[model samples]
Target: MRIYQFLHNAFLFAASRMQAAGLEGRKEEQRLWIQVNAYRDFIMATGQVYLFEDYLAGVAPTSRPHVSTALGARPDTTSQRVMALLLKAFDETPEPEQKQSVSLLIHQVNFIADTGQLEACEDYIHNRLDYAPLAIAHFTTREEAEAWLMGPAEPPSPADILIGDEYYTAVYSREDNVRFMSRDYVIEPYIEELAAEGIPPTAPAFETRAEAEECLKSHPASPFDFVSIAGEHYLAVHHKRLNRHTLHPVASTLTQWEEQKRVVEREEARYAAMNTEGEDEES
Candidate 1:
């Protein structure tokens, strides 16, 4: 049922986009689009009836991803065959919980009465009867219509849930406090040269980028560099290899000893960590 609806929607959207792009044969496309909308509007009302009259009364059906995708786009098809098929599916639901879930989903989705119902439309009834006229009730006000569609709004949409603190979080820091996510935090990297110079890495954390760079002026071999957080006074030194901030005292004040001890220590730490990982993997 959803597949058919999805195909219907896909056709509608493709036609709309192409028409917007000023493609040829727009007149025929427009006519088809209108026909499709009429079918869709008629079916939607019928679907609502089925949900209330039949679908919600039975055990719920499962695994309708295709149908969901089609419903997501909200297409309408007037073909008698598709409408009958969908109405038939309402009977397939068997579980109470499934019915409840679907009921909630229908409310959450807020599928309003399609305005296309202004057009007089009918469904073919084959040998048993003649084409039947659709008489769908529509809402007058936008708010009224939406309220009806959304129902009681029990579970609440994500937008409704993400109130003050949950939404509009601050990013970057300044001299004053700002709202920000954890990702907004920038950590400076520790300098090995500073470690060898008896200055502990991660200490004397630079509150400003200029201070870190001034400290780096002499030792060009150092991998740690400063990056300023947007709109934040604090500048952080980032270590390229470690992919992290030093989070230690700023060691930018140290001079280059032209010695290999600190570099050797860093290499040893890397090798040690790698070996430990390898051993863990083997185990």
Candidate 2:
């Protein structure tokens, strides 16, 4: 994700949460207020906070094609106007099973921009454009901002630690401050148990499946192989460009684990050879 988009999305989420906090009670409202203020202080410190007008002018050219076609014809189209059109289009769209106009609009914005222009727009949003609504609070020093953000500190407990070297899913118990690792995908019960005890889930980390169908965003290319142990298998997912391989278990029976080892070695060799050929060509 681009930094600009990430910030914008985060701000929206925070704003929504803040508005919701009002009805939840004083404590919840105060907590949300502090968090929002801290975030705003952090934004102000970055010195990249943008005003809406400046942001529109800066990214408009690149973003224009991704918006409504009629917007292209107008000389005075503003970001607010574009947003209203998008919202209206989203609202008028049919159900999820049908062709979604909102989905199409999202895809257009997400995938159609030229890479150079996208990067330039992101940089412009970060350094030059205006996002003033996000940064409502100010702090004099980094330490002051950090201290204010952290608020009163509690006594530290034992740091959370992963239980073992290998696992498919891990869950942390705050009561014991221990992370339980498992080879199986049965993590939901543990999570529910924790939530019942008032310990909300931290971010979840799951091992990517080594199978042909199941994959990770990091390693897109599939049909992976794995090292089969006594009965278990660990995947051999390799990235040819990076000359790197990730190991994870997959419950598939196609090739021997020995074949996966050979495949990893082959991928490394191919990448090395390509680099060598490129260097030779340059010379």
Candidate 1 — which residues are off by over 4 angstroms? Answer: 1-22, 45-283
The global C-alpha lDDT for each of the candidates, from Candidate 1 onward, is: 0.34, 0.36
Model 2 misplacement above 4 A: 1-58, 61-66, 70-231, 235-246, 249-283
The lowest-lDDT stretch of 10 consecutive residues in candidate 1 is 156-165
Q: Compared with the true structure, what per-residue lDDT tens digits does model 2 show for residues 1-283?
A: 1334544554554454456666666564435333433333333333323322134344544322244343344344232232344455455545552223233333222321321133333333343322211121233444443343345532111111111212122232334444332333222232233334542233223343333224344544232333433445444433332333444434332233345557769999999999999999999
Index of the highest-lDDT prediction? 2
Worst 10 residues of 2 by lDDT: 154-163
lDDT of 1 by residue, 61-101 (tens): 44441233334343564332232333332345465544333
Candidate 1 local lDDT, residue 48: 38
